[model samples]
Target: MREIIVLSGKGGAGKTSVTAAFAALARDTVLCDLDVDAPDMHILLEPTGTRREPFVSGHLASIRAEACDGCGECAARCRFGAVTRTPDGRYAIVPGHCEGCKTCVVLCPRQAIDFTPRTCGWSAVSDTRFGPLVHARLDPGAENSGRLVALLRGKAKALAKARGLDMILCDGAPGIACPVVSSISGATLAVLVTEPTPSGSHDLTRVAKLCDHFRLPTAVIINKADLNPDEARRIEDFCADTGRPVLGRLPYSPDVVRAMTARLTLPEYGGPLAEAAAELWQAVVTLAAASRPQLQPL
Candidate 1:
């Protein structure tokens, strides 16, 4: 399957909306929302989750008071300084501060430390009007986003393969962080969605650098391209200079907001915005087909 990740170096660049539009156009594809921290694809796709499972990663350490001798060895050995004296004259492990290094468990004279599974979040498989949707939800203030992203991508790919699908449309998280790195890994193509603003241009360059580092084929889609024609020219020039293709440029339209209020894809909204989004989807399909392996069946 061809995995296409739509990403941006910053949030609110219309990346997810573009991904949803592409998903609406694909013939045989699975939609995956890899934005575990703030997944909104489900809102547009209206997916009904059929399966949900707890995702546990790493471990949280707790002290067994009954076994504690209060020798203060665990406190001294803990590098994270998670162990602290309690009002009852005992050392306690703070869940938020503990790094779960297991050093306290091993060095404690009384062997009072116990490691427990930490619930990071939940992953789900859902059925949407567009297609099979694989998405995840992260626990508030949870860590392990990179690992969760990998897991979500793997599930999406596996579902696509099982159903004999040809494409995996992923709405990747924003920024060049760990989650973004996981999103780009094994991607057949990376579509950088940007706007025509100074901040947009800056972040677009950052995302482009990340794609270059991974040697992934990349294309740029400029949303609100008319907002700043001068900046648009600069974006086009930058792409030309760097040998990256400008897939499509979409104009600023309030219809997109209306579509969002209706909880529908841009193409399904049926207006000037829908027409513009259709043109963008055509470009995307052309690129995806071009990037497909020659030996692979279309």
Candidate 2:
């Protein structure tokens, strides 16, 4: 099966919006929202009957009040100040402040600290009009986003295999971080959506270099090309210099915002933007085939 990942170097580059449009355009596809930390694809897709499961990361420390000696030992050992004396004179572990390092657990003289599997967040599978979507949410200030992204990708791939679909369309997180790495791993291609700004240009190069490091076939699409023609051309120049094709340039329009505000993809609204999306998707399909001639069917 061929997997296509939609990624961006920064947030608000319209990555998820483009992915939502692609979902509406693609046929026989399994969808995945890999932006676990701040996922919003479901807002447009409107998924239902999602099955949730705990995502266990590292262990969290909890003080067993009954076994505590009230010696202030745990509080003194915690570098994060997670251990604190309660109003009732009992030592307590603040769940958020605790880094789950277990240093206090090991240092406690009373053996009152308990280290248990921490529920970092949850992953879920839901059915949308397009197809089965594998998505996740990371708890506030939680860690291991890369691991959760990997899990979500696996679930999406499995669902694609089960449903006999030929493609997996993933909406990846912003930036070239661990989460993006996990999202792009073993993918057939990476579609980068970028805006026309100095910051966008800089981040595009950074993310492109990362894709190069992983030997991923990458392409670019400039959104809101009308806002800044110079930077848009600069983006094209960068793509040309790196030999990555500029798939399409979508014009700036209020229609996009109107469509989004109504919880719909541009393609579903049947406008100039939709036409551009169709052209972009067609180019993507052609390139994917050219990039991997013998790609297996799902």
lDDT of each: 0.87, 0.89
User: Model 2, residue 39: what's the lDDT?
Assistant: 93
On residues 1-298, what C-alpha lDDT tens digit does candidate 1 reach at each position? 6888999889999999899988887778988899999999988998875699899998888999878878899889888889999887888998888877889888877778898999889999999888999999998878999999999988998998899998999999999999999889778888899999999999999988888877777889999999999999999999887878898788998988999999999888887877777887777777876853222111
**Worst lDDT 10-window in candidate 2:** 289-298
| TM-score for each candidate, following the candidate numbering | 0.93, 0.96
In model 1, the worst 10-residue window by lDDT is 289-298
Off by over 4 Å in 2: 292-298
Candidate 1 Cα outliers beyond 4 Å, as residue runs: 291-298
Residue pair clashes in candidate 1: none
